[model samples]
Target: MPHDDDHVPRRRARSVFVDITPLRESPAFAKLWTGTAVAQIGAQVTIVAVGLHVYALTESTLAVSFVALWALGPMILAGFVGGALADTYDRRRVALVTAIVAWVSISVMATIAFLDVSVTWPYYALAAVNAAAATILGATRGAILPRLLSPQLLPAAAALSGITMGLAITVGPAVAGVLVASVGFPWTYLLDAVLFTGAFLGILSLPTLTPDGPRRALGLDSVLESLRFLRHAPNVRATFVWDLIAMILGSPRVVFPAAGALVLGGGPITVGILTAAFAVGALLSGLFSGPLGAVRLQGRAVTLAVAAFGACTALFGVVLLGTGLIVGPGAPGEPVVPAIVLACIALAGTGAADNVSAVFRTTILQTAAPDDVRGRMQGLFYVVVAGGPRIGDLVAGGLATLIALWAPPLIGGILILGIMLVLVRTARGFMRYDAHAPTP
Candidate 1:
């Protein structure tokens, strides 16, 4: 057996952030990261604002469900279009354009908030536009990363991303709650606009990245090329499918506001706390992830981490069950959540597990795929990572109304654990994926 020291390559590989102060050496990545970190917080704020506003206006969970269902189709369409664009153009430019479009859309949303609440159509339209734009930005920005760093550092970069996401989700919702409480929706939207400006600075600073092979502009041909590429790559398919399954069954984000309002008894504070706790868990896990670079068993790592996430999600469901049993469903007028601490802890565990899975998944994509096709592949990856949650939002929204808030996660978690086992067992080839030896 190869001992730990013997297993690790001794050639002193450079990290993804590079050596020049992790900022000066890779200003492009730093800029992009900074923009994303700030924007993610803003996103959380808007998410809270929209959910609260909708619930406050209509006082029905089904109305809030419409927000997610409304955005789903446009997002799916954008995924294919975005993937093609990522492969065809300079990814940084693509990201910049999308960010600008999204920024403008959010600005429009802020302006509309000044009008009547009955004007709901504009909110839905603007939200869909922002979702589509965000999808595009996510795909292209992911494709740009490999150009900015060497292969060995991909794991470290993934860890850094997880840590950032954890912090963003953690801080953003907490701040969003406070802001919504004090400043109201317009300022929240305005701040999101300002933070979005940083995204342009990052993308504009990047080096040009022309396609390696014959460059086709975004259209049917680009989509066909991406489809053809996917046909031969089982690992890529597995990665995307695994991600979708995890998010579909395990993500509980959509139920949070309702959980706070109905089950937990604390209202918005509980909602923000629960979401932020998830990020806090992710952030904490990343700090001890120093040896992540040495873990060549990425396939197993992703599998186990996802499993842990499912387990925690199930625990969150149990918290819901306890809330129902110990406290019963709240009266019609009550909007406060109960047993919030337990809920937060469960969410934190889920976030940490999901972050571990994400680090492995990102490294696998960056290391395995060729640079030429990587843009499109990462685009699909973004679709899976992003689109799945939207699907989860739909699932959570509908199911919470059908059965109860607890039913969606309790059932979803069980389904995730079962499906993951079958998928991993059937695709054992993925278990031995090697970063140094890329395969289809």
Candidate 2:
């Protein structure tokens, strides 16, 4: 009896960690996850390196910013088209081709840097191409995920993806900073090309995954069909709307730099710490997400998680306001340690909350949406993921300039809390969404 009782607690302890059933039971998904994780980290490294390289070449912040701007339009367009293609053809083949395109773009980017090319247009063009390809790859991979894992295991799979993204964002940029300082731009780009090849192996290992539904011809009409389907997918649409609420109103990343400079008083180092704190929170949340798998009311879970995000964002603003009042506007580089600590804690809370929301939001989409339109739905998801923060940045920056450093987040957070409560009340279908019978 004693031994059996001891084993109970042991099992409970083990269950607190992320569930590895998807990895153990699905070899194809395991390979795909591993490959995608490695490739994403490498892609992040190149993204950071490109920004730093452009800054080095032109010594202009605007020039560095334009690299992202150049990619945005192409990424959105390619994502929709890629989704159509994935729904029409074998997803594995589509992913492989897009990976090849991305790899080639990276290779050319490396070659240009190796030859000591002074012009910047090549880098810009290559960055745009790589972004488009990557957007397509992401949409295809998302579509492939449902086909690989059983619906019951999908929440766990989503948690694993969160870990992948956390590592990619945190480790990748840190590695880029090290590589760029030790080697040069050429070697950094070359390393990305090498890391990118991992994606091809994952793609090759998969069996053909053609859509198991009515196939549409790949064209504008196919993309239009996806949009039309969205009109009916209230649950899916609610998921996207909830995501936008968290990202647009609760995202405080844009304020980090200015906060560090004027409010926090730690300068660039403080900015870096604030940035990494969010990723650390996300990583930790994924690590202990095993309990989330048993959750049946995933839609309500998402709503609750995002509500926490809004609260945390508001709390972060309060921290900034408190720190600013204590430090005043004159002391830029001499931030009190406690103020910084408090601010990091709030940002970390926001990250943790947002990550939980994401796992359920993604699971809801994967389990509810039909296979034929899953790719396009995922494409819209990628667009939301990519575009929301940019919009938030603009909103935050504009509000800060017009009001105060702490105004945007404080106001935005209040808006999110109010709006989300309204959404939960009115979105009856979404609020009652059950994982077992996912309907959208």
Candidate 3:
């Protein structure tokens, strides 16, 4: 492990802005980043638009949860299988194929909307297909990244990834709201299909990246090997546990549709703003992430950041609770300016804190794992990243349906705070973990 003092000199020279060293040193990384950014923006648009569309059709939060529920199984399967494939084959080809699959899925979704399909099953099925493809693409891309940059630059690269995500959610949802409101679902889905072509440019430009060690057949054993590796790898495993807690307990995105419709109002626009506010906060954090690169005790930083995330989520719940008591539910399509502002502020806080946690967690995983198992490791990471939120969606939706709309986030956030406190006490080794050593 590098001592805290080792970073002081570098810290002094670092700017307040996010370091662009990864981009400057590697042209391939830059192109890949830019292309992925463009494609991810479109993906976010579809995500937001889908939630709004589902809510409009059913007028039920539980129904919106079903969208995620439908996709969960496929996502999990794809993540494991994709990870195995990434290890056994050319990563560039795997990514390209997955991208094509995702593109076709989105195109089909657009066509269904254009045909004025009233049933929700078609949308749900298409979403599952898209989700599966996206999981593979994400896993392959993560494996490809380490090959493109030096070990020291991984933190900056993760920060850049955060910026990509930030821009995607920020711009995409905001655009989706306007486009959906004006041009309707067909056009919104169509636009996503159009923007998805950007992913191809990135994958196509990449050189072939085969796994470094002995290649094995793609099967259950291949997936199990990655799982077995995690059993002995406490540091890497710790990151996954922390992220699952943060995402499953603290993530509040599922309730946005309900909040917009029943509580905060302004319909899709309010939903967009609420979602975008989180991304805006993430964007600002990435912009100012230079100082974070100097931190040696990365594990401690991740814990602290997730704690902040829980607090902010709780704050958001409080805002919703207060708004319900005072302002009450307004007419559909009406904007509640004060409530929206407060909620955005709270959501943005969660976003900022979550972004910080993500940067370190990603850096740790990328640095600790060997190239041979990195794909499978990233695949499991994808499962947590994709599955945790789906479970959160189910929890938020089910609780909001059974109790008050504000109850799920309020309860979940409190649970996260309690669990994290307990975790930090018991997991002493994880707390003292250092970035320089990169142990797993």
Clash totals in order: 7, 0, 0
- lDDT, candidate 1, equals 0.77
| Cα lDDT listed for each candidate | 0.77, 0.89, 0.88
| 195-218 per-residue lDDT for model 1 (tens digits) | 777667777788887657777866
Q: Pick the candidate with the highest TM-score.
A: 2
Off by over 4 Å in 1: 1-25, 53-61, 114-118, 253-269, 322-340, 393-407, 422-425
TM-score of each model, in listed order: 0.84, 0.98, 0.88
Would you list the clashing residue pairs of candidate 3?
none
- Model 3, range 4-97, lDDT digits (tens) per residue? 9999977766677899999999988998898899999999899888888888888987788788889989999998999999999999999999
Name the weakest run of 10 consecutive residues (lDDT summed) in model 3: 326-335
Query: Across residues 1-440, which tens digit of lDDT does each residue of candidate 2 receive?
Result: 37777799899999999999999989999999999889989999999999999999999989998999999889888878888888999999999999999999999999999999988889999999999999999999999999999999999999999999988988998999999999989999999999999888778999999998776788889988999999999899988989988788877788888888788877888998999889888988999999999999888899889888888888888888877787776655577788889888878888888899999999999999999999989999988888888888888888888988888788888888788788778877888999999998
